[model samples]
Target: MQNMLLFFLFILFMDGVSGADETESVMEGDSVTLHTNLTEIQNDDTILWMFGPEDSVVSQITRKAGLTSFFVTDKERFRGRLRVDQKTGSLTIRNTRFRHSGKYKLTVSREQTTIKIFNVTVFGVVGEMDEVKSVSVMEGDPVTLQTDAEIHSDDLIVWRFGDKGILLAKIDVETKEISLNDDDERFRDRLQLNQTGSLIIKKTKTENAGFYELQIRGRESSQRFLLFVTGE
Candidate 1:
């Protein structure tokens, strides 16, 4: 009985000496990897890994006894995705998503001394733009442009028009780009940023038609436009 008490005391002492150094970064689909040095731990020491801002217990491994245990939180997001490798102090998270981004801490305790702290980063999936079609607009009419979103995020909108590719107008939101070719030469002046990623060409004419394109960047997306000009 006395030996058991002493052993418990020793565990506390060792744990107190070493605190986990954790690093966190957002990852796509709710996944992340935690890495740290465990070389100094004795073959007999039991190491435990955990999750959450409070460092709630998640799993444990005893190398000397060849024993292991996993105790995960009831959170639906975690489910079976949280894992720990008994042979090494490595944690892997699968099926990551935006909501999975958060602070996590790890603590390693040996029978004698505590050694290192690791801070890890998990990357969140950011939306991105991949491709779009080139277009040309006429001198006086309305132009509509369009593109596909590769990822999901708040929409960031920017338009490029005119021969010099001047900045037009933007409505920062998640609306998809449209394919519109302007038809007003006065588009050079009457150009108005519209709700449809559309360009209004007040009065239809010949010179207003030309190449127009869109440049959009969002939390997790990007796009470019190419407007083609022609006589209408």
Candidate 2:
């Protein structure tokens, strides 16, 4: 009975020594935040973060006085692409991708024994080009195209037209694809991505039209685009 009582006290002590949020959110193009709430440490406690789905060391931040930054052991593809909120201990990843989603573990340690657990989640935007549902383009004049992908961005995006099977742009987080075939040739360089994978075609004409396909690429996934051209 005496030994059992001592063991129970030890369990209680272990439990109270370290406590961290086991429910971390992981998303593509976004950093997942894991938090620790450790207490009762005589000296200092170390907080270590680990990731899987690729089985790599994500980062480690030692919780001593207040809070510190975690050294990303496997944040190669995620360099300059992730951020952690110091105040809230929240992690945010920029340009979230399908390959960037998975589970992570946080370990807290003092002297004798340490505690660790995992925070799992799936994160990333699909840039739904498949939901294009419909498309419309005009001749001689630039045709405006749209897609089902809601998070659209211009400038830093790729817009592949037709079945040419070529990457239109190098870096497109979320945006619609614009066809190279312009309505008036002059408007060829004046198009851009809209909120819904829609491309803004300028100077519409009768000779500048046809059915085009749209495809969206991400760090881990790709979406297809379908377009249609109409005569006015």
Candidate 3:
């Protein structure tokens, strides 16, 4: 009887450990869903979602006497990006960013306290542009940063240059606004943003030979290109 008791205790311990923690990996600008495996929530049950090392409360839902009250954290990183399902107690995060990578805890309170922990890792994605394709152009020629993807109305495109990552230009598809950061006059009127979020540089110079980066909002990754401008 003592041996059987020990065996049962060991099984319970293992089950508790397995049920307490989980790990997930997702790319930046992607969405992730954490499920609670609950088909229905009773009025007496309470659910809470917390994040990070501090375990700051991100969301909470309490049901009592058939009345439900839902609350969400006011943190800017999670604002307008979190969704909770009342029935299943599942949490979904939209457009996940690097700041969102951390530990998440879900607690359900009722007759028995249940806890679920998730260790989430968010990876930055490299965009679809060809990294190895060295764009060669002669001085005073025009060079286009090619982007093959279709642009959405709500999309935003940003261009940066060099190891210092200096912002060159930004284009907002929805607002149809193009902002040029021509602090050094490197790309003045010579720069143009096409409808497809590509950058066109007219009158390319030898000083333009460097690395350029292109990032699009709602995209899972950014693209980098090496520009080579040779003298005619």
Candidate 4:
């Protein structure tokens, strides 16, 4: 009896793996919605959304006595970014990052657990033109890295410096918010992001002379700028 039960369980697991759906791609900083296709959730039903290969629970909805309550995991990467519809059990992830790319599984439970799988791919955004440009500036002069791409609400722009790729500033194009890395004091009060997703550094210094990289979400491309700072 023990050997027969093990074989049955193995068959069920293989069935679940074979039923997985095709892969879907979403640009970084955008949103992806997953649908359960159920018009109404029953009282005895439980719905769950899990991420990655580890199957970490991301969101859950439970219905009891006709009352539904939603719960999301305390995972740091998903904080304040997950939303679900109470009636449909659809899941929406907002402001997705590159690290969020992986397999997502949705489980529905009543008398038995039914599994549905989705593979999500998050693509990085780079510029459309030449990969790199050169900029020469003197101390105390402003320098701007220009890109002709239109900025969208769900897009994110990241600026990094040097070969080590130290983060300088990250801009959320939708919110028009700029978050400068506190660890890098060299750019304090000198960096600004324009409406066009261009980065403007107010005053250049010798220390700022290096290779800079700009990554824009949704474009799946990146641009590089080499800065040569001369003494004033």
Candidate 5:
């Protein structure tokens, strides 16, 4: 399916398509929208969103007299997590999971055929598995590293950054309060935490690409996240 899509798109745009929104990286349980870059869809135009490897359909959009209808194709696989923008034909996947990671093809057909491909990566939720999972994010995009475990009432969760293990944020579940350490000023005001013990880095910077550790104080378990930043 992937090969067929690539070959068909290559034939359609032999010269190439400009500025295809090609890559997106997100964490598990997050939402991502792939834009079609169109201000509006004409009545005669039909848009199809396909996911490959198998090249299965994700959703299709068509317009009638004055209204648009969206048909979600792989509903069982996506479990009703797909959405589309009526005007732009952009597709959004809510509460994304690892199985949602793949290449998506957007085909806009009207007077002519235009194709765009997007590569999406969904990082697994950090757990006590103690694995160094690789995460990718675009510069200036916010990325979150979330844990799968529920916050215990008495747990003190600590999030650390970089190889030096700089303190980033500490969360107190008992008090529902957080203490942030930005003495290095690198993260300054771009770091935050959620009640789920997730570390969110906003406006991601290239230097922020490194090992991130999540540990609960007094526990012997820890998990690491290796992040890579692109497009400075």
Candidate 6:
């Protein structure tokens, strides 16, 4: 799955109608900017910056009726992390994480479409983080782990389970699609991911007690949930 996504973006980077590509490397938790090289943005120009395999919009600057607007995606990964240079339409990612390492495409639209592609790689390995929460639930009861935050219109949320980090469920904001346990039957129909990216385990059993991880694309960090199903 990961390779296929990389290939898809590779094609876009290689064979676009018009583009200037650049490579960037920054340490984790640092800031990096992708420049558009435009001296000034015209009132009729629309600048868009997208990231990741899904090409989700991370930031944008647009003008309509002489009204200029700057918009950044409110995704958890990008929360308080992305900034746009109003004058030049450059995009900056602050406090970068490894997940931020991906292809970024900038599209400037007016009479002609100008494209710029950036392949960003954030260095440094992330060690295993300490578990932040312990959840206890009774067998045969439903347990919900709440993320308690609203994501961007097109945020990608991935949920994994157990010590092996098994694929449990995913919420694709771009397509508004949800899939659960494609390769694991232990979850089967028992897993439910809510709109807010929370996980609901129905009829959870004692065996469900384990480690679970929530990965929000664009997130600088993830919250680990340690489930302890009781009354087995």
State the C-alpha lDDT per candidate: 0.51, 0.47, 0.77, 0.75, 0.79, 0.76
**How many residue pairs in model 3 have overlapping backbones?**
0
Give per-candidate clash totals. Answer: 74, 31, 0, 6, 0, 2
Cα-lDDT of candidate 3: 0.77
* Model 2 lDDT per residue over 126-157, tens place: 55423333333444456565544445454344
For residues 75-125, write the lDDT of model 4, one tens digit per residue: 787888889988989988889875565567888876567787776655567
Poorest stretch of ten by lDDT in candidate 4: 14-23
RMSD versus native structure for model 6: 16.9
| lDDT by residue (tens digit), candidate 3, 1-232 | 9999999976765443226457676777999999888887788889889875456899998999898888987778798899999787789999997567656788887666687877675656766323323466778999998876677889899988865789998999998989887675667667878878898999987667566788887876577666656545
Across 1-232, the per-residue lDDT of candidate 1 in tens digits comes to 9999999987787555655344455445655677646543346666666543345566565555554544555567577787776557677778765334333445565645554433333333343212334444453555556645443346556666544665655655555443332443345455555554544545444333333445556443444443333333
The regions of model 1 sitting more than 4 angstroms off are 1-15, 18-22, 39-43, 69-74, 113-124, 128-232
Better of 1 and 3 by lDDT: 3
Off by over 4 Å in 3: 1-18, 127-232
lDDT for residue 104 in candidate 3, whole number 0-100: 79
Listing every candidate in turn, what is its Cα RMSD in Å to the true structure after a full C-alpha superposition? 20.2, 18.7, 17.4, 16.5, 14.0, 16.9
Sorting all predicted structures by lDDT, with the top scorer first, yields: 5, 3, 6, 4, 1, 2
By summed lDDT, which 10 consecutive residues of candidate 5 come out lowest? 12-21
Error of 4 at 135 (Å): 37
Model 6 worst lDDT window (10 residues): 125-134
Best-matching candidate per lDDT: 5
Q: Residue 173, candidate 6: how far off, in angstroms? A: 38
Alpha-carbon TM-score of each model against the true structure? 0.40, 0.35, 0.48, 0.48, 0.48, 0.49
**Model 4 misplaced stretches (Cα beyond 4 Å):** 1-18, 126-232
Q: What is the lDDT of residue 13 in candidate 5?
A: 65
Superposition-based RMSD of candidate 4 using all C-alpha atoms, in angstroms? 16.5
